[model samples]
Target: MRKTTFLIPILVIAAVIGLSSMFIVDERERALVLQFGRVVAVKEEPGLAFKIPLIQEVVRYDDRILSIDVQPLEVTPLDDRRLVVDAFSRYRITDVEQFRQAVGVGGIRTAEDRLDSILRAETREVLGSVSSKDILSSDRAALMLRIRNAAIAQARALGVEVIDVRLKATDLPTQNLEATFDRMRAEREREATDERARGNEAAQRVRAQADRTVVELVSDAKREAEIIRGEADAERNMIFAEAYGADPEFFEFYRSLTAYGRAIQGGNSSMVLSPDSDFFNYLKSPNGAGQ
Candidate 1:
């Protein structure tokens, strides 16, 4: 019983010591062993690792890429068009030793802040050289590439590898957009109104011309009709004159009878009678002595 009691305590102490001196590195993590707060060794592979029991400590860093989203910032294009830009960065700790020596475990936030400042400055510098039309058009990719190259160089000095730099969103502020749209709409409406006015003017001119043509046509038709009627009347007069010349005695007798009928068919009115009156001669006409 005494031997068993001693052996159990010894085993417990050994187990505690073993646990304190050893650690496991996961495939997804890299560790740095620190002694008295100084980096003594770095373990980059996954496996069991040994260290001093109480004096040494381990600091672990993620081996996978980390994503940090920057706050939205205001930027301007070459045309002085203001916009809000939201961006993010993807990075990984490539050299754990250098990363630890440069920035401790709690320095990721500071690194992101620094990177954000650098990215914002460089983004403005790069995009400021381009026009707003180009920024909104097919040249956005080329601008992004240039920005990434500058950002990568900046991030490398901090012992981090920049996987990518991306602009998530670019937008004009609401108030500015509203003003711009209003101006654009007004201009378009002005153009449309001008076009409609020109069309109306053309239509009025064409209608006036058509009215004048109609008047001329009516006058031409009236002239033609009057000429035809005059021609027919003249031809009838010539035929009548030729017939009257051939039969003078018959025409005289016929003219006397026509005059008697015209004088007698009348309402009675008082008239002074003369024996030599022409009307009376017509009433007595059919006698050959009447001239």
Candidate 2:
């Protein structure tokens, strides 16, 4: 019984010792073997790992991609307009030994700080050198691409790979935004007023031209009417003169009858007429001239 008790205690101690020396490394975690707090080997693969109990240690580091959100920065463009810019970067560890030596097992804070500085400097460089219009429109994408490339180059020495650099938001300061909106509104109103003035001027011109054309058409029509009336009067006068010249006696008799008709038809006013007057000579007979 005494020997069995001794063996059981020894087995328990051995089991505890074995447990301290053995460890599991998940597929998602990378293990770093450290001796006396100094990195000796880096195990990036998953599975079981061994270490000297109480003499060597293991530190685990994340191998997955990490995100870093940078703070908003103020930038001034070539136009001297101040804008707030929020940015972020994505990175992953590529070299574990170099990463531990540089960043010291801290996940992404070190990389974040480094990238933030680079981003601020580059952002200032890019924005200060570019026009506001270019930053807002034409060169936004290109600027982002250049920033990414520059960040990648800078981050390489830190054993980190910069996957992307992005601008989260860009906005003018509140006071500046209000002022710009007012200016734009004023410009639009001015344009609208000018357009109205031009439209009114054009309408006036068209109306004046139409009136002039109407006057000309009316004048032409009046001239044509006068010509027609003159032609008719001339034709009637010529007919009468020709008949008078062709036969003097018959023409005289016809004219005398026409004068008598006009004298009686000159309204219903009172008039005295003498009996046996020369005006009756035409009514006497067709051949009663001397009568």
Model 2 lDDT tens row, 1-291 = 999989999999999889999998888768888897698878887888888888898887778888888788889988898888888878788887777777775646776787778878877787788887877785588888787887777788888888887788889987788898999999999999999999999999999999999999999999999999999999999998999899989899888878877777756666566767777777776676655
Q: What does the lDDT come to for candidate 1?
A: 0.83
Worst 10 residues of 1 by lDDT: 282-291
Top-lDDT structure, candidate number? 1
Worst 10 residues of 2 by lDDT: 266-275
lDDT (Cα, tens digit) per residue for candidate 1, span 133-156: 776776588888888788888778
The candidate that wins on TM-score is: 1
TM-score of each: 0.78, 0.71
TM-score of candidate 2 versus the correct structure, residues matched by position: 0.71
Clashes of each: 0, 0
Question: What Cα-based lDDT does every candidate model obtain?
Answer: 0.83, 0.83
Model 1, C-alpha of 32: deviation from truth (Å): 1.7
Model 1 per-residue lDDT at 150: 84
RMSD of 1: 4.4
- What CA RMSD would you report for each candidate? 4.4, 5.4
For model 2, the stretches where C-alpha displacement exceeds 4 angstroms are: 138-140, 225-291
